[model samples]
Target: MTDALLPNILQFIGQIDPFDKIPKNALRTLATQVQITYLGKGEVIDLCTAEQEKSLYIVRTGSMEQRKVDGVLRAKLGPDDMFGFSVLGKDASSDKGYRAIAIEDSLVYIIPQTALQTLFSAHPDCAEHFASQAQVRLKSALDVVWSNKEKGLFIRTVGEVASGRVAVVTADQTIQAVAHEMRMVQRSSCAVIYDNDTIVGLITDRDMTKRVIAHGVAIDRPISDVMTHSPLTIKPDDLVLHAASVMMQFNIRNLPVVEDNKVVGLLTTTHLVQNHRVQAIFLIEKIKYAGSIKSLASFTPERQAIFEALVDGRVAPEVIGKVMTMIMDAYTRRLIQIAIDKLGPPPCNFSWIVAGSHARNEVHMLSDQDSAIVLSDSATDNDRIYFNHLAMIVTNGLASCDYPLCPGKYMAATPKWCQPVRVWKEYYKKWVSNPEYERLLNISVFLEIRTIYGNSEYETTLRDALHSNIRNNREFLSTLVNDAITTNPPLGIFNNLVLEKSGENKKTLNVKKYAINLIIDLARIYGLAVECDLSATDERFKAANSQNALSDDAFKNITGAYQFILSLRFSHQLEALKQGQKPDNNINPDSFGSFERKHLKDAFRIVADLQEAAKVRFGSR
Candidate 1:
């Protein structure tokens, strides 16, 4: 190793964790074994064929792409990222051949497996840091793949696996008779069928107790009287999770598995629940128990587990939002608590306000954390001083937890964000009454706020003031509508998705910015105009369903568009996570299959239609 390279390596290590406590001689030993190499763009620095000599390579500049045996490019790695630790002593001919190719001219430092092990033995923190970063990237990409697989619409047919023996009853059967039969079969539910096996209805334990027994309906009457007619049925070939969704949505315990329009088998909530990957539930529980920052940081693995389950669970969009929000809120609150502890107790009570996805309780895997602070006005000078310090500590603590600081300086630590409740109300009133560009943008972010920690009364007051101002302001509503419509979705000439055109992200489509947020903005405006208290975009749309503010056609169009965009974003983020890269919304459209491209086009069309409708509604105002 060159003398200059040693200092650079030491400096990099210092940035991660200072090596001041290590013996000088041991540091020298580390410096001696390190090797540096320069790679030009498109160079293959490490191939599966070089599996005999395992080494960890850290990027100093530029990026690398990892690929599988089928030549499908998997992930892109950037500066300060490490890879190749998993290839040690593995046979080259094994199925797990991974290749790394440079994306641009770059410098990489290599550490042999033996040296890394030795270094870890002495400086465990360094090794843990590297491992944590690698795990985050890998888990993120895997999450994408898992989510896509779960959301894919290909239905599985029941005829393919039907055993031909299924519990069934005729509509003429009495509830008591069916209940007795169900108990005899050791099943909680059964399907009602006609003479030729056509599924006419279904009944479950809840149906028996709630509809028949509770109503004092004669149990001797036909089961059809108590059974749900035309119950939601799924084809056997449909995905198992699709049936699970039907169960969850209708609060039913059973589904009739149909094939060729005939009942072939029965599916129960227990089947769905049992098949669910328990790891996800475990992860959610662990996150709930994470009472400290250090404990929360250990949840990366748990987060990965949840990501994987979400993909595999194929949960409904609403449920997905709930699950993601739980983890995101827990992590954010834990980080804030850490910061508070670091800064000592606050001199006065304050509310930690989460904005954006976190605030709406609809956070996805790739979403960034956005938050603020609303201090109680009863604070003394000492309280202000203590809170300001606490805010910075909280912000930095979140950054360490993989939530990078907001590039727009909207974070809680910013002086503009950390304010008393009175200041926040004034900010809201000014934005609502006078719709300036910057003010409107700020208002959009603020609309999603939720109280994460501390006294929530301050948040309640601020929300009430915002709603009160918007309720009577027709002109302000129209201006907001115009602003919402201005996003225009991502539609291009001939109704194509307009992909990004600059820098390393060229040819990628920003699903979150161009597609999802467009729907969110429109929903926000509609909700505000109608005085809907819902915060989640989907919930807002549902709340506006009855109002003439949005026509039925427009509501359906926007809802479908939002779901399609969210599914795409979820898939992209999961893929990025699995590939050991940062989960993001920049997805290359060309990478999608023909069916996905078709759906994406349809989603964009829906957005465009909604935008046109908004323009028409507001232009006259």
Candidate 2:
């Protein structure tokens, strides 16, 4: 390899496994021995031939297809896919006649047997990796990709990538002082204005131009006069997506990150654009103003692309769910707004409520409609007619835009679900007072709700009332826990993924039904039992754990399982999209490489332990 490309190659190989396990100096030496080659279409290399058998090939670009002696295709390999599995064959003189041919113009790197042997002797793990059977080799390779991404991306929290030590100024400081500070720093374009250590405002250079310079306002005036008061803020622990959303929502270029009543740092558009490749942020803006059902429907491909980006970025499932939820939030609100425009304003104050995955903000690619209308107490028959028509329009529009209609008729388009706040409370009253099996199903769905549109007070009053009832009503919570445990996580005694052996989903795990729903049920039970308002699964577990409603280990096991199951589901959907298929919940265990197979077993074990813990906690309640 040329020295110009050697550093890049060495850095890449250093991250991938077998190479990663080897020392840097050894990798540098191996980098020198690498021979890069280009091939045109139909260029064949006989891997089984004695002359080529001793060389290992890695496809750096384009595709190479391997075939058996009879010309039946064995596999198609692309960038980063390793081949020449028999490079260290015991019988070097034998020819097996299986050959790999470049199906397109290709670029590949070859490592000769001599250099490989030297490196292998120094690092036995590298040798063992290459010598392993195909199954084992497949696993190690995947593990390499995953481990490198883990160490590289670290997509957990804003704190992971945020800059430290934000600049702060007092609210009473003069605009002149703020402008001077902005100029002095030169590099940083913004500053947070604080009062008693609480983030009161933020001032960016743009603000200085639009508010002060343009208006020719006296620069000697207090910074509060020109600063953006009560600016939208984020936490250091918040996801970078949150910061991006705040910036997008408020149409501001910077946000003051507050943690524990202190400004921790400033997050700028520059940071987000430089660091994250998330497209969902851009997608949200488009949905907000999309007026027609046809325009909204056109984003189906971009919606899929959003999922693909999150999956490829190795973002955590919880964050992925929230980002997707944020996108749907845009869709839901815009639909409601469009509906309102067409149907005229509502007859009374109301809140558009979204429940289930949408409510919990744990949405995946297949998130369907789960919504209701909570009208004001003064609503009448005319109001009912107005809302019923409105729900039909909005729900239908959502369906057209890839949000399928709710299967159980749970959507607000149904007249019964479109009701006044008082009537809604009555429904909760009856459901809680008598938790019959059917009513329990509704309770499970309704318990987690997010008010996407209209008067926030309506949902707040209803949720407060619900929480109040759940606080002392042990019977209601008992029934909830009982319902939560009705379907235990589908795991066999041997800790294998227990899939349906018969029926349409035969030989596949219904990840949504068994793994995802089970976690949701537990979170609902624990959250309601503890009277915690949070509906997100991870937050519910955290709240319960902090309150000692769950043991430390129980909390860890359950939340860990939740994350893993959701991650698997996202990956599955992404895989489906790549294959030009519709994404769904069913996953075949065989589809997973051994890396996922091992984690799947461990995740299921955690699920089992979680079920046991939930059972014990509610056995007497």
Candidate 3:
């Protein structure tokens, strides 16, 4: 290959990923290995197997259509597009059930399998590109900044992924006219109904079917009559994960995105769940219909399967945490409903709440139940008795569904926790004012509360009280920071791993106590110090960094360390489960590879450095 030809190949393939990330010298070398071919229009290449045609095909000019043996169009390739990954899956246990053929007279570049394998081994990031090569890039496929495959394909913002065309109508428009406009326009699944540019409601195909087609509502009725009012909305820049979360959380398919107070895009669940088989959204819907705790328990194997899939795909730990939290949230909500069915409606308005990891939305397979109840001020002694019974049944139900009761008895079943809104406020006020041992413990665990079911306003009352109390008391924040700084990362005399000297997990690291929780504590301290109500560890850290409390290096180091430790801890627990052992935070240092050990130490050092920084900043309380 001449230098001029190599530069041409570099210019062509540079538009793609992994190749774009490769160093210029290495990329030039890779470009030299390419072999070019040409075909006439409507010509079919009998590219049967990897052994027969062991090369990747990249279209240089003209278009081509890849089809299955049975005649289904798999993908249409044009300039810069690549094909022939089906051949690479030769050892995939089965055929990919597809092949490529030419639709137009074209010039294609071919990279041999042997050369690609050598390059992939040389550059690990290139391997991801090879892995995703088999997936058909249909339309508007993007190469985004996402590094994990667990989210699958891309993790671009809603604005980037959402269809650019916004389908909308006024609330006063007739359903007939709305339906006509939908069919005449872009054939949308749903349309956002607005009132003078403010999004007021939404009408979906499901609503049209159930509310109109089934019930036979007049076609000329105002859209406001059947439209869902005050619909859930997402910001244009929000992550696609958040869009999936809101869709699954509310059991809706269409999500409208607002930007600058204008409805800009409507993203469907179809956009999110196209490639995934077992999404949190899908699982949550199943949990909702589960008739009993036993039925919900039956889905435990499915949960394990989902966890294994995410782990095997090498997704970020924060991604897994959010996914698992959705499952925990589903279980909590279902158990509450089961309790409600048996006990009938409560005597007064109340809120069912969850705290700690669940509230933070950073849960994992090993997280336990930390919860409470906030009742309306109108509740009487008899009402309290009813709520206690309800809480007991719900907690017991949750246990049956694999969510264990709180070890510290912080559950709603306890009378001290199942209190009226006014009493809960008083509790927070006293805890903040005192900052004693027990108070500190309780406040740390319960400070980040989230509403799960029932009247959310009840929880809002307690939340406001807690926020108010923290604002007036900076000493308590310092005290919490002081307490937080004491739980140092486990590094021994020689800077080796400090393993447990005794316990069931002897000679193992308690990752939760020593590292994960240490980060959590620091995050909580930072949150309180900045008066940031965010609960997720990464969010809290970022919030602190935004407030100029955390140095740039410290922010990056601590966040990276925290996520890596979480990933390690999750991997350990998952391995334990697969091996028929009970999973815990205890990870044996002997199991660590040289690579893991090195990174683990670096992560610990960051934790220690951050702790010292916090202690110095906050000082002794």
Per-residue accuracy of model 2 over 127-221 as CA lDDT, tens digit each:
75665233244434334434445422224467766666466789999998878876775345888888876778888888889999999999899
Q: Which stretches of candidate 1 lie over 4 Å from their true place?
A: 1-277, 284-292, 340-344, 492-497
lDDT of each: 0.67, 0.76, 0.76
User: lDDT, candidate 3, residue 220?
Assistant: 92
Give a tens-digit lDDT track for model 1, residues 1-621: 767768778766433222343556776687678788899988896456654477877777777766665675444555555566446433323436567788789888787878867977887644533342222322232333335444422222333333344557788877778888777774545645554566677777777778877889997998877777777777775555445444543567666777677666877656544545444344545554566766666777667667655745655455566666666666666666666667778878899888887777676665665788898878776777787788787777666666667777787888888888888999999998997889987887888778878888888888888889987676776887777666666533111236676888877777777788888888887787677766888778877777778766567657766666676677677777788887888878667653354345446656766666676766625
Model 3 whole-model lDDT (C-alpha atoms): 0.76
What is the TM-score of candidate 3?
0.71
Please give the distance, in angstroms, between residue 297's alpha carbon in candidate 3 and its true position after superposition: 1.9
Per-prediction count of colliding residue pairs? Answer: 22, 0, 0
* Cα-based TM-score, every candidate: 0.55, 0.71, 0.71
In order, what is each prediction's RMSD in angstroms? 19.3, 14.1, 17.7
Off by over 4 Å in 2: 1-157, 160-198, 213-226, 312-314, 346-348, 493-498, 589-598
Model 2 scores a TM of 0.71
